[model samples]
Target chain A: MDFQTILILAQDAITNSAIYALLALALILVFGVTRVIFVAQGEFVSYGALTLASLQTGVMPGTVWLLLILAFIAACMETARLLVSGARHKLPGALATILAPPLAIAALVKICTPLHLHLGWQLILTMLIVIPLGPLIYRVAFRPLADATVLVLLIAAVAVHFVLVGLGLLFFGAEGVRTPPFSDAQFTFANLNVSGQSLCVYATTIVFVAIMAWFFNKTLYGKALRAVAFNRNGARLVGITPHLAGTFSFALASAIGCLSGLLIGPITTLYYDSGFLIGLKGFVGAIVGGMASYPIAAAGALMVGFSESFSSFWLSGYKDVVVFTMIIPVLLWRSLTTAHYEEEE
Target chain B: MKQFLASISMLAVLAAGTAAQADITIGVNLSSTGPAASLGIAEKNAISFGPSVIAGQKVHYVIYDDATDTTTAVQNVKRLVSENKVDVLIGPTTSPTSAAVIEAVAASKTPMIQLSPGPATISATDEKRKWIFSAPANTTIYGTAMINHMVKKGVKTVSVIAVDDAYGEVSTAAYKTLSEPKGIKTLTIEKYKRTDTSATAQVLHAMQGNPDAIFIASSGTPAALPHVALIERGYKGKIYQSGGAANAEFLRVGGKALEGSFMLAPPVVVGEQLPDGYPTKAEALKFIKAYEAKFGPRSMFASLAWDALKIVEAAVPKALKKGKPGSEKFRVALRDAIEGTKGLKGAGSVFSMSATDHSGVNQLGMSLMKVENGKWKLEDHAEFK
Candidate 1:
């Protein structure tokens, strides 16, 4: 109600909004290109945070093993399809492509984890362990169903979410972990106190937001993905493989998720299942943008964060209820403003 | 062939009769792989060290993971009672899981020893609750200890930020009930979900009163969220934590922010720091030595499991005399015997349950602890009514 309280809440909102904004961008990107609403996107967040925590403690992270498992499964799926198609000559190369990265990463993790390297190395290692699951998942679960209906893909995404959550619990244990902050500096602005970490989060989100805009508007790969999102079959006819676009988009989404996790891990405690609610919030933001526009999605996520912070003050127990309900009006408006057309599907 | 078949049938019948009489099956349901997995893992590790032979009968533990879900807990309890034919049930590690299976335990006439940290886990007013006994120190006792500490520190007004669950409901109510009589006013009450990542709004709202202290009534590591938020907001007042948030993970997460906070925990938390002649000193030391040696570090949550065994060790022999291990009479007798537990000191607390008081742990079982240099140190303490 007062200025100071408002200031504090705004600061909290901005810090939280940065995380949600990052996630919202990823959700939009993945949904646009992959045609799969990646429900398991948030698992990458927890995996990234917990993997870093594990490596920092000089322990072998469970993600290394998970990556290997995903790699092996993907290899089996690819190899079987090639052999059934009588492409025996492509089988060995296909196997190496699918299997080699995870195997090499697992070896690197085994060697570097015990060395108790600096924070930068630990972070890079965490990303290395977690990022491959994006494409591997696409290969193993989504690729087999790539041409399936959206409903089928959505169902598969949910199933993958559960599997990842279960594996998260098994790999990371149930207790939540908070990493040591990257910087402990405190900033006293004109009327507010912001930590260095919050500033870091804000800077990182801005940089990524800029990067995302550039990637979508300026890059060739991004244009290919845009064409695929526009029309999958038409894009394929024009020499843009829908599957390649899907895999690339998934990789980008995974990297974004990993970055969001790394950013938020020091700010709050994160459990194996914590990513669901946060990711769900991001999905809400994506819906506000009609799940298509990146800039709008980021803006919507900030709105969600600010509204959540404010409502938690008034109706703290109903914070989630209030935030989730905001989507209804936006949805009604989206339906009213947008034209309904015949589906390409 | 006919003679051989008849002899085999006779041998099987005899072996079954002897095995049933010689071993008492105990069913344990804990959330080993879900939200409450931290508590369950600790309890499981400690319970595995329970006495395998009790009162000349082999003790068989049929353990199952309920995954911290109410439905899974009900299913596990039903299967344990119907199929395993357990004489007594030992767990359902969290309050939600424990509360969900009360009817199943009562219907099957199985005695249940609950290892949760809420007084609301079992209500004496409920008829079915007679079959269930609580093992951990009641959260109200923890609230009392915290309030007493506040009084000593001359705190007048307090705010509470609790989890929006039964644990929080019971805890905040207890704080109000205890604090009001001491002339300390309750300024604001706020609640947040355990998975909530931000408590900035709640902290600001709670700070509106500018109370002398703020009590966090949350379970496990989640308590650290609100606590850290308050500290980062530059609030100068004292911060207090409930015994439910006594785990080392809470300390680890809260880190430097928790340096001066107070927590009411069982004596087992600072067992080595416990003064001589404390009620749970001997048992706490024994537990710390053995548990830390094997498990590397001790989770005070493990004491809930350890205390359950202490109750069984003290009560089972008396119940065994009433009937055979697998019979309905033995279970009823075991329930009655545990309810009649008096002055039995265990790893975490002193247990004394009665028909009307399922959790009879008093102030003596709890110690006021302060976090100094990342470890719990027992304070020079006084008692409260």
Candidate 2:
């Protein structure tokens, strides 16, 4: 290939890698603190994209209603628990917590949707609508089973994925929707011309990664989360609440997933089920990183993007097969190198 | 007195059963809620406009959603044949689903009219296609038209990029077959999955060949990926697309990147732009007006479905003369009547079905369209062979 061709192909790989990196990081964060393989990480991506699509059309998305319902259920569960324990004072607080956010969000959506806000504000609102479902779902489905084995948690994750997919169909129909690009400029350098959307994707990914690095290294909450990941029982004994860490981790992962979806929406037409395949690609990257190291996961995701791009050039029909087959070698190397240990009852 | 009442009741029950059997049923299996739902929805809307009464028999439609799944499509066909006992069947909107249910339709001896492009293998011989008829023009006719246009333009080398699916495989193969015989060199062939977000590598690889033109064989919004990639990379060669991209949705998603691209589409796509002497122009315009009035827009798939129902409408009266619609004898007569269709002008084409040719629409049924100013316009210089 010529130098220009090679450069263009590399650009494609880097753009894809940026999206995959976000997904890989989300997977690692959720799996580390919660010990759950989040199979439905992709569903969050679709929800975010479709939510933006609805908002663009000036309609109140079904996601807003879903969030309201889930929050109400979670609040009711907490309230019921407090009442059963005869903690009458906490019941009022529980009710307030459960009822306030949905009411506020609903009112905001009701007022702003018809005004047809700018794309930037619509995207922000979409993220705000989607991010809380992460923690609410945890409280309703996963928190009760926090002490269960990883296998059971994995199955629950798969079930959650199906529910989200079905809900996605209901919200967004089966037709694919494409969001407007953040910018419409085109930059030409020598023989290559780059779209403004690609530049936005790169800048956003870099900024988010840097911010995450600072958060994990400098913040107290981040340290608490690390402590939880290191040893849940020990963290609990040290006065760090494992439940808080779980909620925080899921909330962060879901935010990252939603951000990735927003970034990708303008670049491609996305259907309700598109997220599963994209998330599977991210899972491959996470697997390569051993699901622990953020930097390694990011690098692995870049490798996946590069491999997919080059394989499409060389063996176009088998590019997906090639990228997916990469997991086999990484698995073999890990199985041979890492020591196995049983959990203590 | 009790015996007399029982005998009268039995006679009434028999009469009711006979009346029910006399009603003609048209079974419809479509992907109403899956990846191909847009096409299926449009087709469903078109079929709803079908005549409610034909040949003094009340026409009843039994519709099922296959969700674009192969197994579900086959199951729907079986149920329609065994349970509904439909005299005629239409659709399962996508090509893969349509192809999957062929054997069941044939085994049940029911006449089926598919609303999408299918492979020649499903109707390669008269015996194979005895009970099946395709509504749209064959893929080969589209390929031949495109290749003929290129050959006339003095193009020598071409590259192809297609989705790695049945539709892509069939259309690309047809292009190669037609182009090769006409002394055009196929430089390279590349494939990608329909869900792929980027086509940079495929486009870059095709650019290496430096062909005169590139053909993209894909459907819906997926068709825009390669076109955008090629334009961004500054490859200025001609781009041609398959008939599947002939829809407003494709144009809406593609935007300015699709400008200057050429496509082979059924004449119904540019019905208003057809020449005054065109045979199917009046019928096409009438159908387009009715469809757009009801659905707000006319799509190529909707027109295909409209034509499929029309073909069935024309054959019903002839079949009614042989036997009542519920009987197997009537179904056989209907199949034969459809096979004998000649010079019938519908929305998409002038269909001429014969014993050996189930896909009766030929090259004349197609028109070359150019994407100009974000819309499909008829190319005046298009030569029909």
Tens-place lDDT per residue, model 1, B1-385, is 9999999999999998898776989898888877777788888888878898997888999999998999999999999999999988889888888889998999999988888755665766677887888887786788778887888889998889999997788888888888888999888899999888899899999998689999899978899999999988888999888877787778888899998888888878888887678778899889888888888788887888888888877888999899888899888888889888998988788788877888878777788888999988888444422
Any idea what lDDT model 1 has? 0.87
What's chain A's TM-score in each predicted model?
Answer: 0.98, 0.96
Q: What is the i-RMS of every prediction?
A: 1.2, 1.7
Per-residue CA lDDT of model 2 for B160-226, tens digit only, reads 9998888898888888778888999988999987767788899999988689999999977778878
Candidate 2 Cα errors over 4 Å, as ranges? A83-88, A188-192, A337-345, B1-21, B124-129, B380-385
Instruction: Identify the runs in model 1 with alpha carbons over 4 angstroms from their true place.
Output: B1-33, B48-86, B117-127, B320-330, B380-385
| Residue pairs clashing, model 2 | none
Query: What lDDT score belongs to each candidate, Candidate 1 first?
Result: 0.87, 0.86
TM-score of each: 0.93, 0.93
What is the per-residue lDDT of model 1 for residues A87-175, given as tens digits with 9 covering 90 to 100?
99999898998888899999999999889999988889989988888988888899888888889999999999999999988888877
Q: By summed lDDT, which 10 consecutive residues of candidate 2 chain A come out lowest? A: A336-345
